[model samples]
Target: MGVIQLPSPPRILCFSFHILLILLQQTTAERELKFVVVVFRHGDRTPIVNFPTDLHKETEWPQGFGQLTKIGMQQLFELGQYTKERYSNFLNRTYSRQEFYLQSTDYDRTIMSALSYLSGLFPPSSSQIWNPGLLWQPIPVHILQKSSKQKLHFPLRDCPRFDELQNETQTSPEFQNRIQPYMDFLQTMAVNTGLELNHLKMLDNFQLWNTYDTLHCEDIHNYTLPVWATKDVINKMEKLAELSLLSLFGLYRREEKSRLQGGVLLNTILNSIKQAANSSKQGKMEVYSAHDTTIGALQIALNIFNGKLPPYAACQFFELYQESSGRYSIEMHYRNDSSKDPYVLTLPGCTSSCPLEKFAELVSPVITENWSKECGKQDKMKDIFLGFDVAVGLLCIFNLVLLYLLYHYGRCRRRNNYQDI
Candidate 1:
């Protein structure tokens, strides 16, 4: 073998300096994750009975309509397991009330989902196991029903301004143009569903979405679809629903719409992030269990929406990290599929790992100081009367027109006994 010679002292010194520089850079770039925020939709749930023509009956579902299924429970349990695995090293081995907080919308599916999630996230360790037979522990999931200030529901159903905005969107030339080709198909659907031809002009796009939802839910649970709910019909309904939903949050006035809807939730999450950064006592995780609309609205506000219906059990995640320099950075990830890793979502205006301050500034325009004021809630009586008048006017038209060719495009079609859904 050829003899190997040692380098001179100067050469060795240079090599040592290069190694030191590499270590210094590595240390400077290192970051420790400190906090997490997750906003997620509830697991699989039965559809509420809004589409009268569907064959699914509330009695057929063991838990009644709009309740969670066992499959849903298992799905969330898996999510919890995934979360536990993801943070096992970072979080304490035993459960700590001080490190985690959970909230959910006041619905059977969401509350159950939260519970199922907790069961998976923190199964009792040997130290905390209370009973020999039971492998789980109780964790509180906060919910408040019918609260005036709750920020979890989407589209802000009570907001007159949002309603007004929606009507405006429905009437825009672009909206009319988009739905023009589907008018006859819509009429055929209406007649097939027992909704009269005259009533077709009065049907809202959301109602069309409801019809699709009923069929979609039926398929998920292995229920046979009616002859009317053909694959072609479903495909069209899906397209319409996607268009209508995206338009509500993005098409006409994205920032303004966000200021009224998703911005409320965004504000809450940002403040929580700031508090976590500034305080030593902040919880390690904050979770909000809500619905698809909630996640869609939040994503739209953040300018990271993927322009598709968020599937059941979807999650939008915010993770905070403390860098070696003592500054904080945030990373956003979205998980809508259980089969693959969550997708890394970069804020529209920043790098993948964005600084906390810069992230806040970029999203400031969407945040609202007073949601009620921004939503046109000046006086109780004024809002009620105005809302009634708008509702009456709104029901006269299909908001998202589908009978434009057969009927006079913009003429109102009246319906009796109109009520909010």
Candidate 2:
């Protein structure tokens, strides 16, 4: 044993140092939530449309189809109250226009939902009251017309590339694989439900969902259920309907579709966060009152969709935080159920308190600077422009050649006439 000196304790020392580094990261000081962004679906409402077999007609509902009911108002009010309580410390006791911005789709249901939510969020105190009879104060809720509602809503059907993506998703192996198992069931349901089997195959779950939701709502309100509308049957329909929705926004090239639709909203949200983070002023919240598609699109973009129709008044929260060390982070939570706490969500590759820069980096792929350009529409337009320029150039050259030929013939005719004279 020639001088076999005991190995130095470097390896053990290195292990101890590595463990301490992890411990330090784990025990970093807590961060405070600085700003909040809430995107929620409008509360429960009558079905948007009724099936032929549906006993529950749109006329039965007080406000007709798709309008927010009293129950819907209550749901949003409760959500607002809950929000008020949760951010009591963060928000000013009275509403400030500067501190909050509320926006909704142009639809009546969405606009009313925002108003309902505001009622619970900031009930006017004595001095703030414009009218003593009403506890509410008017808060501006912005909207974009149906023709221009792309940024706030989901499944923006205007983009041809998105339509192409949906077609591709339908034919994709994953979509085919997932739906194959349910084809027989869907066919049977279509027959009973009076929906065309082919149409069922090309499922628009959101549309199908209206039928089931109407029947379910009727049953809940003590209306007699149809013979085929048992609880189990409704549950099955609801599941399949959800699958249809999933298929629409999920599977092959989901990211690309998201970039066109949901990612637009995400880009807006991130831009808002960046603006808030960079600016010295701060706000308590921003609420985007929209539809179930809005929630689904956002959840899909965030990769945290629960794979079901988000219930009425479902709220998705994006909370911004400032750490003790002056670093900012983002946290997300989803409140689909009133009885339970909002589900805490972490970004795919980040911790609960994800740093703002890291959050942006993680979501960069989904966001787009130019929606039309990224959707391939702008490129198509560019190609059309080039083709149009070439066509115009050829037309101009042909006109010049025709003019030269005419001029030459006239000159020869005039020269012959002059020689004869």
Candidate 3:
């Protein structure tokens, strides 16, 4: 989201090679994109966290911290244009809410990113142009309230088992062995940043990530770095950040942790894919605008993570295609580098053209029928109010408590089933 210029061609977009594969599948060799799902990280922005000795403050950035930047807008705009072209044959010439859907985490940057992407994906047709002066038209980008239990927000903090898994990940022998050489580095970073990161556990928790994010953002913006944060020092910090990201969803009991974190999102995506494959009337394409960690969690769940921090505007595509034989196949591709084609991602143990049923079977180990119970969490309420999206007739224990309960229950807590989406 900083000043890093996208490599020229001004359009660094990616389309899956399926454009050719589907052609080969059919006698006519025509486009066969049935349904598509896209999950992408928000474009770059100001750093969200700062070390105690940080040089920049919230006010220093134009829109304050964690908000989208001009570069980010351009990035998503180009990505949207790429999407429009990629699905040209499949998509209607004009915007149609029934054909496409967009959602984003309840954040300024993500909402903004979705809007920017929509601008390029559905630039105004003559009929959609409410204002001829403006080349854009507003489109709906659905969002759950911030308090809702949404899967798009990964490493969801409400799950006790996930927190336990993270603790175990830090103490695992494999993790200790990986960080053994960085003991001195942690101590040096602690001294330089005035942060308490003398132990690997501390780094795994957050201190190291904060340092790396701040420096990475600063470097992206071409800000002068502190003397202690030399090139070599930043490289070491980068490694620790990568490890920290991996710990968030993997490293120990990967499948169990995934069932609680990334698997939740995967479940939602799979359900949509299944419904579309079955000829459900749902939209043809779905896109989620979220964070880098969301991308990491999802890729880790799929067991195809490249083990690198997903860069700004990195988009992952999940396409459902019906082959010439009438069977449905799912294909995944990752577009992290704008300079090259999206890296093809095949579901493990399955071919690139993975059958929908086989893809579900391979990922079955991570998916859960009930994420709440699997997470070892109990949502307690009046037994009478059980199974109700909204609890009516609050207890009369106290007026204030009653009002709070009403407000809380008024917003239906989403179930892991993902049908609500």
Which candidate leads in TM-score? 2
- Encode model 2's per-residue lDDT on 30-139: one tens digit a residue: 55677899999998776678777777767677878878888999999999999999999888889998899998998889999999999999999968999988888988
Candidate 1 lDDT over residue span 118-212, tens digit each: 99999998888998799999988999574658669787778888878887877777677777788898788887776665444333446776677
In candidate 2, list every pair of residues with a backbone clash. Answer: none
**Candidates' TM-scores?**
0.82, 0.87, 0.84
Candidate 2 backbone clash number? 0
lDDT value, residue 255 of candidate 2 = 78
Residue 75 C-alpha lDDT in model 3: 91
Off by over 4 Å in 1: 1-29, 196-205, 379-421
**Candidate 1 displacement at residue 143 in angstroms:** 0.7
Show the lowest summed lDDT stretch of 10 residues, model 2: 203-212
C-alpha displacement of 132 in model 1, angstroms? 1.7
Candidate 3 accuracy as TM-score: 0.84
Candidate lDDT scores, in order, read: 0.84, 0.83, 0.84
Off by over 4 Å in 3: 1-31, 198-200, 382-421
